[model samples]
Target: MSSENLDVSSELKSDSSFADRTKSVSIAEKTSVIAVEATSTGVEGRSHAAETSTDPLAQPNDELNKCVVVVNKESGTVCDLWDDHFEAELLERLKANGWEPGLKLVKGEEIEETVVAAKSRKIGGLIAGGGDGTTNSIARLMLGSDIPMGILPFGTLNLAARDLGSPLEPLDAVASLYPGRTREIDALELGDRLCLCMAILGVYPELLNKSEEFHGRNWWRKFTKLGSDFFKAFLSSPKMELSLGMDGTKAERVKSRMLIVVPGHFQDDFGIIPKRESLEGGKCTLLVSKHSSAWSLFRMIGNFLLGRSAQDPDLEVKSAATLSINALRRKKVLLAIDGELAKFKVPLKLDLKKRALLVLDPKASEE
Candidate 1:
């Protein structure tokens, strides 16, 4: 199985494919309800024969026995959903799995300092629980390290965890952490900055800013607010003029209002948030909107939602091994690297490197 999208409904018991894997999984207590449940059917599932990555699974290592779990107390899932005994339950599960687990539950302010300190201890693997920003921090810190990352779905979107097919529930995530095989995954690099998932350029982040009002405190992944966000962003988004192309080539450049760079590209279908079938291949697709006019933007999004052809006149689809993006006359551009916003130097080269980071996949072992 590929890892994440598992059904929690009563019908899951009737799913023949999951029979074997589910037998080994010990469901946790219901009293400890998580803010974020697992992904719905068709996302990804904990298939022992993992299907998303092109690479074969690495040998199971005993070194995973020593791990340090870094939890963010400020994340909506942890703060709003988890109970007081959550830490005890997590540690107990790790211990039950034969790991010498050390726990560090810290507030958002101490994440950076705490992660550095934890890495110095030379633990075999680092497990992190928090939002997308927290996931990005650990990815940047431990990018090339030998130790792998195990994710807990405390983020609103939990995109990384969803991709890894790890359990989204708090204890279920910890339960699967040490049991899975470690896999080397791909990531997008920009100068010294690296993004584990996708990156955005232009006014798209404004839509997400308004989305939080609709999201409120219910942190699980949902798209009911996309309509509201689209409406709000349309009214206030500033115009943008950009030039996109590959480096050392002046001929390939094209004008654009926005850019959505994804590793392995999004699924053709939309309405649900876009997902990639695989993130391992050294490939990326640039989804660009040529004009910033309200009508053009509407058509661009309309084509995407309807799952229309990628070769639409208003939207330019460019698949490349590398991408260079810059504003018309600006020296800097606002970039959202996995939901964290920052001003990045223009003429940014978006490069894809395969197996850039090691992560634990919720792979089932033969019983």
Candidate 2:
């Protein structure tokens, strides 16, 4: 089988969670508003703005009385994560927890526009559903805004959700976030973009993600094509020389096959992606690799995944509040940002932004 593009949960437990609930109309169609069931397509919540105030954005100042649920239908695991009536059930859950709820099932391209429109409704909280990439997009969109966000892990890995102590199960996740409770968190800024987790620059992304499309037939063909690409990327100058500077210090030269940067350090040498120490630590850790070849790097990663860490000289971990990296020969480098692939310009700069986001945290309220 072609392995998953990123680490994901092996078993996606399908839990049964449902009850009667109320729904709101989309904030976009305020002129011709009509009552619709909570689960109706493109539906939103009971607009307190519509009934009480002339301005549509008449939201409460302190309490999160209303929430808009935005689900990216194209996310990898969304199709199997919930039932057809999930929208209704989710709205009901929010209602039971004292929230005015709205629902929008949108394709990937419509996510930003759909969300921005809802935010104009002055929603108290924005509950975003998708994988790490989708969550990353929403978090970036909400940055510097007063709106807090809640995450539903419906994509592969769901690393961001894991960091937030959210349940991998969809309903359990929603149930966890009490209506008004939220936690402030931080992020790492990459140029103009935001990274909630980590950014990796290395040969693996170049090798695996370079394929524009894997056509032909059968799983073996796909795996064979992948192996071929891996070897080619490996053989084509597997190592790159990089100049790194931390906290505006002078640059130092280093050779690496893979370089990993995290908003904070990853503690415990276990799991596919280990848990972070804290999200608001205001420090970044750079895991630089000196593994000689593709095979060696693979072994090192495998060791990490399998929960074994020997203090080998091949790996170095450095910490900084701000970092600069320049590849010696390459103008742009293939990168994995929160498990999504992109090509970043040379001289990548990274820094920490503390208390940048307020995410719904049921655990915090429960505590």
Candidate 3:
């Protein structure tokens, strides 16, 4: 199916968040204020009185008093951050704010079990200490539960955490969780997988698949495999028919080179990266590069640089509430969800779940 244009400006508005201007406030105030920001959309979906009404820390909220922090020790930056005494310092800081926070350092495979154990204890909140994948994994468990979550952002590219308004600094992020709010963010669903940021298809996934064949081989073998994979993917990338809507009415067929699907409210940095203004927005953007041409890649780059939406003949972008895809060849499609590669059976359906996650809200900064 061809990508159809949809309007999403109304869905891109910024929500209220804690402001950096109050940095000089007392430690208690810091806890209450950050919690106030987190619960900005209060129980009734209104502003919490804590913002300008009452002290959140003074309230007898058991959920806000106890917390668990999950660290992916294998993540690229976690070891470095932890070695610098980040955990001890944060624990001391949080304890001073009257929190009984616990820490759990786990390998990648142990993530699911750790989440279950934490939830079984009915912890007030969870703070993920890694990159997007780790954050996404933790979030999946917190869905439909009262357990709010926070992020430590130790990944190579913590896009999901950044989109949720988390700071890059470990100290600021930790301190901001003194009191946390439950935020419902839109999540993408494809089969059993949850995509927090974006889902990728086409040449990138093909290249990922090909490169894995030489993953443990020597450098020369990996380098040679990369080149070979690129040429093969460029020539052999499959054609697909994209169908939109739950009923599968809208359709377009393209000789796909690459396809990137992002939440309707993806973050915008005015850089080469794709921009979406709202995570709670119930919409998504489909960025498709047709014909698999090298020149189309350059055009995509230029469009991003110029802040122009993709509407050219070779490349186009569509924003919608949901979409579906089917391989014309009816074969397994290589897909990448939040940077992790996987294979999904075709005729895949994707839809958005609005405000499906809760996170510690980072305050707005003038900088």
Candidate 4:
């Protein structure tokens, strides 16, 4: 589902769809786990002769044998919720499915090392267990490779995992990883940067900046500081004169406070939360907000929250295979790439890599 509003204020918020469930998942003991040996194809666990009727009905075949699960320890779900007991239970389920788990907690340098190691061992499928940023990092490495990837949905929204039809439950998501059909989806690329979800420009990144500070401060301090930052940003919001050029289309110029570009797969019915029905298409949706007034922002958000169309009369929506965004009246502008704030050079170009990444879809092979 799409967010309640396009307010940059909620930019840093992760997916909160399943946040309220407090019951803990009961992890099975290690005695219930099986072990696997690393091989060129994947980790081989258990033997055909030992195959028992008690095993789960959908088990990975030999060609699909080794599945590596790489968890970003710094991710919200892994850091806050995962523990020794959870890890043990997850391993047991992976072993039962004839897959090996390559669990890690590192981000930048160490993540690269892990990908190299997995490739050397010829892993069949790779499962990324973390938030959107972590998922993008791992998926970037798997692009254009034959190795299919899975999503564990440990992030706040788990948007990518949900779009792939993965189960939110850790064990269930893992089991659905293997013995599943692979779906190739588009990944947005801006030179060396890869965007798995959506990209935003203008006030959204400023909101994310304030959000990053809310992590370590007290409630009062954070609230006051955030409030101050919000007013300052709102009062000083820039009306960017942007010229957007799409392939085979004329460049269009508009003055707006923000621009959101997402793959067409993320498009949904009006008033409904935006979700991708299929990842096969090689197109994207561009949303341009024409008004920067407070009332307009509130109205846009209120519409979305009420399950009504949030289309701003001044807003513009277009379908394109490639987009060229240029700040016609200004220089450099603030950009948010998958929620991470940064300064993007003027005249930025975004292209769609259709079917460039192979992902494991839980419902692909379902009856």
Task: Judging by lDDT against the true structure, name the best candidate.
Answer: 2
Q: Rank by lDDT, highest first.
A: 2, 4, 1, 3
**TM-score to true structure, per model:** 0.73, 0.76, 0.71, 0.74
Over 4 Å off, model 4: 1-63, 213-236, 265-274, 306-311
TM-score, candidate number 3: 0.71
Off by over 4 Å in 3: 1-63, 96-98, 211-247, 265-269, 291-293, 311-313, 364-367
Cα shift from native, residue 325, model 4 (Å):
0.8
Model 1 residue runs over 4 Å out of place are 1-63, 209-226, 235-239, 269-271, 291-313, 364-367
- Candidate rank order under TM-score: 2, 4, 1, 3
**Native-referenced Cα lDDT, model 4:** 0.63
Candidate 4 lDDT by residue in tens digits, 129-207: 7776668878889888888888876765556776677787767888776544677889888656677777888776767
Give the C-alpha lDDT of model 3.
0.61
Candidate 2 CA-lDDT value: 0.68
Clashes of 4: 8
TM-score of 2: 0.76
The sequence of per-residue lDDT tens digits that candidate 1 reaches over residues 1-367 is 1111111221100101212322333322221212211122322331221233211112223454667677765553555555434555676787787666655666566667766765665456788888777787788788877778888777666677766766767688778866446888888877666777788876666455434432112543345556556655654665566766763466355555467888776656664445565778777878776655667766766777776637468777777767777677877666767766655666677778778888876654222
Better of 1 and 4 by TM-score: 4
